[model samples]
Target: MTHDEIWRALDALAAENGLSASGLARKAGLDATAFNPSKRIGADGRARWPSTESLAKVLTATSTGMADFAALVTGMAAALPRGSRGPAARRIPLIGLAQAGGEGYFDDGGYPVGGSWDEISVPEVGDPNAYALEISGESMEPVFRDGDIVIVSPGAPIRRGDRVVVRTEKGEVMAKELKRQSARRIDLRSLNPAHPDYAFDLTEITWMHRIVWGSQ
Candidate 1:
């Protein structure tokens, strides 16, 4: 698996358990900073990977089987348990990132609205307002490729370090990791190092939705 995929899976696992990366490491009996973003890259600018022992500890602490963890890493829905599937495949709205910034695709709250969107069928999410966005640029590369589809949940609670799709009042739509959110400003970290990070005042943001899943 790719380095990005592995880290993303770990992040997903932690989020699934309602914990942060550091919290997951703590639960696994590892150093609290073991899974922090800063730890993912070495001081020399090389990628750092988690040890097998650490992975073992995390799986044991969370009671997660390798198969389930594999599902998260590969973004393969079939690898997950059949019983965990939604009642049926549901068609959700799908639109490209470029089109997303256009006028009619989303409402003020970031919910998919209008007839301009295409649709795709996937396992249902709890949010009826959930929709999918197709990646189109290199700004979020490696973690998300040009054609990758990310499921966005407007109703989900966003936390620090979560991947999110944000729309600006000026009609700019971009995806980045949430670094911090204050009453006045929101900070975002770019997934691609080639891109610049963002810090915008709360008023500059129209809506921000948490990225719940990725079709890697």
Candidate 2:
């Protein structure tokens, strides 16, 4: 399997079990930091993969079959049994990226609130608090163009290299790739190289949500 797909499958497994990556590692009798984003890369900047033994332990701990795990890796876990069809589409809140920076769109915990939001039908996401944001500028172009709709999941685990939407306490919102996150700071990489990368203190961020899907 591809490196990204394997890691994503592991994350999906953890989420499906109502556990964080560290929690899944702990449940499998591995070190609590084994699945942390920091552990996914090495000191020399190379990818670090989870050992087969660790994967086996996780499967045993969760009682998940290899076939099911493979499905997750292939992003077909949402399909019906016997490969019939995917989950039905459902309505979720939709808002512009610019408007998301304004008040009345979200609760303190970052969940979409208020009743004035427009709605769009998308394939079902596990997170009930998921919502969509329509892109507006060229700052994130080449990857996310203007008018692109991205699905954001507040409940999803954030990992290194994942694209995310971040909102600052001062009411600024932007989408970038998560380079790294430490206790005190977060590093972000812009999708468009012309745009400057960003680094912010953890305190400056009001919320950061993973972008689970995007309409290119």
Candidate 3:
């Protein structure tokens, strides 16, 4: 497709996901300011195309594919139309990889609060408390390697098979599968096949956030 067409599709895809251009970039783990409208034009006034990597990142972050993004670029109704710039889809707070494991980045309810965080944008998540995290460790290998970004929705229900981020009172926040939960403790299955299942006391857990999306 032509460069302008691809750019337009990116625009439509952002709208389809209820985010502004910059918001989408931030959610993709890129600089929150890189996709600003001002940068879309060269100093000489020529339209610029988004870099290949940037485009791939946004697509992955939004859980959208290139084919659909192409349809969006053409104004086709392949994807549902969302608010052009919904505030909820444009203001996702981002926690750094290192800081995400530290204290004060998450509230008692598993929502992000009270931390120095960067903001990003993505499609509507319905929860005002939704946030993003950048993966920086090899612990969650295969499923999520370093540099991947995952979106967490605290308000979303935690089902049996859903992937989640759980924080313990001992200051450990980890991503795992919710195998089961009892009043006393919770059972977790690791994404890494070689890792064994874990059980943690419910009281030892502080909060948990269900992962809604990821860019890996």
Candidate 4:
């Protein structure tokens, strides 16, 4: 088989086993970088092959046989289990980060309630009332980048040290890491390195919601 095809089969097998390629290698008692892309090509520019011992260990670790590997190679294997699927078919409102700071996008309870939102479908959702906001700029980089979607659970508890979405009575919305909270004030660390840590009076914050998931 061609190198690309073999690598694709290996990736598929890793997902079927619910582990990443590096994770699979580690589970098989090999170096974590064994299946990494950097090692997929040789210094002489020839296609690299997985060592036979590595293959044997991987198969034994996963309780998989050579026939299963062959099935993957030939595209004859059963689909990965639905529970391990990435996203479900349920839909939720998707709002842009820029517009999220505007008025009328949220209700008093801090849940998405207005009609200005677009929509997106996820593979599954634990919170039926959750909504999504797409990051718009490089401001939240390192932790979240442009176009990344964060699923906000308005009903979820907001605790100290959790990443959160906070709205204010003045029509401002912010996503940041919660540093502390008290009856009188809220302190936060910005995800964007360019931004400074912030402190706000509890009276100024209209609502707060903890982010439960994200599509990276």
The candidate maximizing TM-score is 2
Best by lDDT: 2
Clashing pairs in 2: none
Tens-digit per-residue lDDT, 1-216, candidate 1: 777778988998898889999999999999999998999998999998989999999999999888778867755422234225555468889999988999988877788999989998887555788898999978898899999998887876676777899999999999999999999999999999999999999999999988878877
In model 3, residue pairs whose N, Cα or C atoms come closer than 3 Å (at least 3 residues apart or on different chains), thus clashing, are 9-73, 17-123, 23-121
Q: How many pairs collide in each candidate, listed in order?
A: 0, 0, 3, 4
C-alpha RMSD (angstroms) for model 1: 5.6
lDDT of 2 by residue, 54-155 (tens): 999999999988877886775445321323235556789999998998889999999999987999987656678889999998989899999999888887
All candidates in order of TM-score, best leading: 2, 1, 4, 3
* Lowest-sum lDDT 10-residue window in model 4: 75-84
For every model shown, what is its TM-score relative to the native structure? Answer: 0.66, 0.70, 0.58, 0.60
Which one wins by lDDT: 3 or 4? 4
Off by over 4 Å in 3: 1-89
Which RMSD values do the candidates have, in order? Answer: 5.6, 5.8, 15.7, 11.5
Off by over 4 Å in 1: 1-83, 86-88
Instruction: Please write out the lDDT profile of model 3 over residues 98-214, one tens digit for every residue.
Output: 677787777667777774888876765566777888887777789888989888877765656667898888888788989998879899999888777789988888887777667
Off by over 4 Å in 4: 1-87
TM-score of 1: 0.66
What TM-score would candidate 3 get against the native?
0.58
Q: Which of candidates 2 and 3 reaches a greater TM-score? A: 2
Q: What's the distance in Å from true for residue 106, model 1?
A: 1.0
